[model samples]
Target: MAERDEQSGAAPGALPRRAIALLRRLARRLRPRSVRARATLGASAVVALALGVASFGLLGLLENNLTRNAQADAERQAVLTAGLAAEGRLDTVLTPDRGIDFLQVVDAHGRVLAASPNLRGRPALSAARPSEPGTVRGTWNGRPVREEHRQRVVQVTVATGSGLVTVYAGTSLREADAADEFIRASLIFAVPLLVLTVALVTWRVTGWALRPVEAIRAEVAEISDRDLHRRVPVPGSQDEIARLAATMNTTLDRLEASVIRQRQFIADASHELRSPITVLRTQLEVAQAHPDPDLWGELVNGALEDTVRLQDLASDLLLLARLDTAQTPPSAAVDLTEVVREVARARKGDRVAVDTEIAPGVTVRGSALWLARIVTNLLDNAQRHADRSVLLALRVDEAHGTAVLEVRDDGPGIPPADRERVFERFTRLDDARSRDQGGSGLGLAIARDIATHLGGSLTVQDSERGAHLVARLPLDAT
Candidate 1:
């Protein structure tokens, strides 16, 4: 079971799995879905978090500073009272300062010696009895005091003639507390408003940033097969958005070219098919009208010829379609030498004397059937034009990493100007449309397309008297 679990990639440890799952769910819930939402929320979240931290830190610093200042003031007053007692004017402490809320002097026995105006003759402000004379202050020092009508007080002790005296001082905390409360309330009110303002600003900015993309999307969506010539708007900024628009236009250009070629192919195929159909129909109609027994065999043979032509034309069309849309890489190892020899053997015993000089080990990577078709097409093309002899050659150019094949014939060679044009579909040299030529005219075109699809090339080369065609394919290095 452990091995199976491991093989299936299950988690290996007992852990806080439920907690982890819950956290993942919460994370997913908090995540914004759209680009615009994510941008706005991310910006707002960062700003809100910063404001919260800064507000907390600033409020804490202010409170600490205010409390320390109040404590320092009380200690200063206590020291001043001790100085007055040393000069025999300790009673002067009864008149407290303006900010002072309370002041009192008590003896070692906890008896009041001097008191502020409002606390005259009151009991000792502190509940703890004072330490004995010459006692070191520790826990024995006066404890914190709280009066019924005032906040807590700070006290200090001083040595006097009456043994040891304690001075108690306190000030109202209302002003400091009020300032803190005001700051807290202000932050509480302003933070949400700031966050809302940030969210609004971020949302608007994100929309503005995506406006060009939206325009491009709308333009692209409007485009279809009917109007592939139209292009998306390109921004003038020369930024990434502009690059995207340019790339999209480039893609549209390719799509338009493909559509045009497809339309031309369909038109050409339809026209070619109609010719045989019309001829077959005419021949059958004439035979039916005449009803002659002797000419029936001739009419049937003619119909069979037309049917064969139609079959060949349809097969060529299907092959072209497959070539256009084929995505599989050609990895079959093919020997060009063998393919050429095979074509030569098949085309022997004809009027054209076929010769071969096939070198050994001229190997390439491609479909064997297509490779054989290429050789067969070339031989057939040569046979049609050759007056006496055709030469077939296959050799390996190891230095160039290529396998080369050539077909040459002693016939009225293709003119330099019409060499490239002959490879077009349905093209023929005989402008008179002679049936004696006997070809669908897609042989060389299909051969060239197959060579190109196999990462190779087929081209017409300059010949002195006969047409020379050369096909080159990348040699299989392995």
Candidate 2:
């Protein structure tokens, strides 16, 4: 295999890389996907680690404290025995104190001079000798003594008739070790139980907190374009989840309004188109039935008129669709004064007398074609409804940073209540302003849409004797 690998020119670490990749893939697959489960597992791992560290530290402190106390007891016992030996009043057999486990006395020659009751004939418990200060303390494993395990031993030396004698006093570590074992066993049992409890609590709490989110998801999933009126359930907690629900409802409201507007627009467009088509079809059928050359000319003219109206309606619909999408930005700086004057000039010979109050050097940022279209539509609307005279005025409102264009006509003025309603597509007031007056009813709507697209506004304002229309566009600073 090695030879084959070498012949194949494989890298030395390829196998290890593949193994690591496989392990990562397995880990990803095994990882918990639910947020609640992940939170529970994360919290458990942290708490477990903290408890483990604290347990080890506690055990260490316990062992140190126990060893210190034991050593202190042993030192005190050894000192008392050394004092007895120095006075030459030592007993051959000594009784141990409540804390001390064993006591023994030896001379400079290592001869055992005294022993405790439990170690009557036992040899010296430790070979430790005192320093120049005549005292020493240390641990000793009780070897050759079948009963004792470990002890804290302290030796003290004294000068007497026998020259130098050493007293060895020791305390067994059985109680401290037993205490440590008991606590270790408790922690060993308790840590896992605590971690499990924490995991269960965390899982339940996280699930409870996310219940609102689940409800929202379910409600949203059931909602379709047709049912945009439905809203997500908002929790009463007034938390981030509640705010999210409110925001979702707001979005749904806007979506519902947009769907309604689109439906209305389609219906209106269909009705408008059907009128011209129906009229044209009727005229053609009449021409086909009569087959009279003299009447054919008038029929063809009427058919042509209906065809023109249909064409105009189609063009208006297409323009409105483009404006609705609003895919492009107005990048050109057009002179509002020029556009107004040019459109007013084209309507010089109209039935209604047209008058212009033009202002020069009034510039705005927008497409010239749309700007002209706004002016043309406003003029057309004014001329169609005007009794005798239509007034067009242009001026720069430097105080408001806008260019204002006003078109007023001496005609039946719009009612205050129906002022805004006039901007609706395919809307016509009573018989006086019906579709028979060569008006598509989209003139005002298209004008308003164009003004809006150019970051401007078009609206019907109060007039004393006739309709007053005003348009405002942002003035170009440059």
Candidate 3:
């Protein structure tokens, strides 16, 4: 069975499947690569198909009309001849009229009594003795005069004085056939020319329309990371290609902004990290050069503090990097009230008093650790700036469907102009605060970033006597 199957070349339907696959591959290879060429080819194919069908239809209609006319002429000629024979005025060699090719008269005994000049001395063209006048196909013998050709023959019977007789008339189809051939030849020559003209026009139009896209592509290809500030040219026309150029320019603008921001971030991070590292290194170097036991402890303490600051800055930088890239939303529900109370309680016994007025059961959906960090950062900022005390408050804004956390301090309030700038990384108000205060300047920035990641916002609002910072997070509906 295996041998027999192999001898048959392939399993049932497998050959057809292989052939179809080969054809598809060939089609793909033959397909034009450029959009303009493909458009031209597609348009040409459709037009050619339409023209071919119209030509065939035209030919069929023309052939049908010509055939009907020929049949009618033959019938009319037969009727006229039959009338003449009935009046006993028939001639042996009759003169054909009205495009009729031949005419014949026969008696009931199957004898040719009279005929047209072309059919003289010839036998009956057809033996059909139709009761009513009707047309049929026959051939003209043309024995002694004209050439043979296909004809439409119409026979009519009439009761004449010499018993019964039949009249035959016919018309040659040579003229109609010649008309059909001419039309067919003309169409065969014209269709391809028309299709070629259409293809050429389509190719030119398609290329013109795509010129803007090509310009955009070239501009983009010339642009690089160092030259992201450069923009693609926008066409004046309000078309899709114009819109595409505009969109490309917009994307370039965003890319350039992102690159600038990244560079600025790196510069700032390096500056921030350098401060603690420089201090620690200098302290170590001075202690090493002096080698004094008395000042060793003091030097070590200062070095440890610088090291701690370095550690904190590194951690803050890492957290910011994660927040920038993190896309997953916080899934766990956390009690905002508890987080605030916990942070405030931990901050007790500090130089500035920490106070809290948290509403119970104020819950939100976010990472609890990050939520605690928000409170911790806000409280730390407040403590560093407060004159005497820091107030932390958590409340549910039912109407807005949010949990609002506000931290306020009784210190010189932040100026309205610097409020937004304060949230930027490594920013510290020189008149109001200093680096000597042991604040990394990233605390508030990190707090704001966490709030944004959790689908919330943190901002400094108007306050009576001190800077008032507010954080709002959506409440956990579940």
Best by lDDT: 2
Cα lDDT of candidate 3 equals 0.86
Model 3, span 137-232: residue lDDT tens: 444444322545556677788888767788888888777778888998998899999999999999999999998888888989999988998988
lDDT for 233 (candidate 3)? 88
- Badly placed stretches (over 4 Å) of model 1 are 1-38, 60-186, 291-293, 410-420, 429-435, 462-465
**lDDT score, residue 74, model 2?**
94
Number of the candidate with higher lDDT, 1 or 2: 2
Per-residue CA lDDT of model 1 for 1-478, tens digit only, reads 5533446465555346767988999999988898999999899999999999999898888866776676666666766775676456887338777677678887778888888887875687666765642222111111233333224356666677657777777765555677778999999889999999999999998898788899999999999899999999999878898999999999999999999988988898898899999999999998999899999999999999999999988988999989999777578888777877887888879889899999986789988889998998898889888889999999887788998899999998988898898888878886425655748788999999999999999999999988999999999878
Local distance difference test values of all predictions, in order: 0.81, 0.88, 0.86
- Per-residue lDDT, model 1, residue 379, is 89
Residue-level error in angstroms, candidate 1, position 410: 4.2
Residue-level error in angstroms, candidate 1, position 274: 1.1
Selected candidate, larger lDDT, 2 vs 3: 2
* Best candidate according to TM-score: 3
> Which of candidates 1 and 3 is the stronger one according to TM-score?
3
Kindly list the per-residue Cα lDDT of model 2 for residues 185-267, writing each as its tens digit. Answer: 99989999999999999999999999999999999999998789999999999999999999999999998998999999899
Worst 10 residues of 1 by lDDT: 134-143
